[model samples]
Target: MDAMMMDAMSKDMMSMPGMESMDMDAMQACMDACSACEQACTVCSTQMMDCAPACMNCADMCNTMMRSMMRMQGMTPAAMMAMLDACIAMCQVCMDMCMAHADESPVCKMCAQACQACMDACMAMKATMATA
Candidate 1:
């Protein structure tokens, strides 16, 4: 079902410049990772840890990134690339902050893991776009 949705999305994006060769798989993975990261960060933020601010910021960034990916009708490759870079940077900061207390906080550990996955997915999406 998701594959079919992606196929429909890919077709919709075919008319956009630089989107003809965009990999829908990478887009889906990135969106999924962003959503997961956002949820994880929101949960971790409630733990009242030092990483709370970073977690909040990361969650917002992930939400924006995921939304941008979903609504790419007017999005340019360059703009999407910039958003990916910002998401990657935010995830890195949040991950570092979470990792600092991962040994003591399970939520932090989970958030860190999610952040890493989001970073990897965004990077993959960036690579796919770069070659397009």
Candidate 2:
């Protein structure tokens, strides 16, 4: 999304119960990372490898995480934290599975990198929330 759109969404989120101190930039980055990870996992899942199921699960989790962040009015701080943790865990599992075949499959390598990026973004968001 564009800066104007993210700013607009952030402004709307400011009205939510626990979003008063939310970091819009960090949130946007996390959302972007989730989107990228979802796309990478979707492609990886079509490879029929051992990691396919994990990639599929991670893709779903990332999409849900991104959507939840977009709809902050329906989320509590605790729920958001839990969801981030879940996204991180799923990404880790997917990354590990993909790395096992990374040498043989270029797609798996790409998926692993995407998973790592998603995990980093989620961690950054969590850190931002902690100080908020």
Candidate 3:
């Protein structure tokens, strides 16, 4: 998202109960990671590998997670936490599936890296939300 957009979101989100003090920096990083993971997974899914199914699923999950983050109005902290947890879990599964054959496929390696980054970002977001 853009700075102007985030600024607008910040103004709107400040009135939300649990998200009143959300860390926009962490949110931005998580969104960026989710987008990268989604792209990587979409590319990896087209490789006709055994991990393709997991890659596709992860891509969808990442997209949903990013979208949810971008649209936080009426969203509860618990719901956001759940979404983060789901995103992290999906990323983990995809990473594991891709890592199994990563040595033989550069795309799998790239996808695995993106999944790991996404997982890390989600975890960070979760932690920040918990403290927010």
Candidate 4:
């Protein structure tokens, strides 16, 4: 992300207790990672396999996560926790589905990895919130 965007995000994130300590670079990386994962999952879901449903779910959750971070003002601690749980649940489902076809399909393997990464990022964010 650009410096101006980082500055704007900092201005917005500073009001949140734990989030205030988050480095701009780390936040930007997480946002980019989520976006990439969402896109990968969406494209992979078009294959019409059992994994399609889980990929669809993961795509929705990742989009929600990105948007929630973008509009942090609307999020409370309780709401953040709930969203985190939902994201984790969706990621788990996606991972399970993708793993079933990972040996045969490169896309499924990549999708599973992306789901895992997104889950890790969400967990990191949730941990920060808990500490706050």
Error of 2 at 77 (Å): 0.4
Clashes of 4: 0
Q: List the residue pairs that clash in candidate 2.
A: none
| Model 4 bad stretches (over 4 Å) | 1-4, 13-26
The local distance difference test score of model 1 is: 0.90
Among these predictions, the greatest lDDT belongs to 2
Q: Per-residue CA lDDT of candidate 3, range 46-114, in tens?
A: 999999999999999999999888777867888988889899999999999999999999999999999
Off by over 4 Å in 3: 7-10, 13-17
**Residue range 1-132, candidate 1, lDDT tens digits:** 166767776467533455665677788899899999999999999999899999999999999999888777778888988899999999999999999999999899999999999999999998878887
> What's model 3's lDDT at 103?
100
- Deviation of model 2 at 24, angstroms: 0.7
TM-score, cand. 2 vs. native: 0.95
Scored by lDDT, model 2 comes in at 0.92
Clashing pairs in 1: none
Q: What are the candidates' C-alpha RMSDs?
A: 1.8, 1.3, 1.6, 2.4
lDDT of 4 by residue, 24-117 (tens): 4545666666787799799889998889988998898888877776666667667767987898789889988998889999999999999888
Quote the positional error of residue 129 for candidate 1 in Å. 0.9
Model 2 per-residue lDDT tens digits across residues 13-66: 643476576887898899999999999999999999999999999999999999
Each model's number of backbone clashes?
0, 0, 0, 0
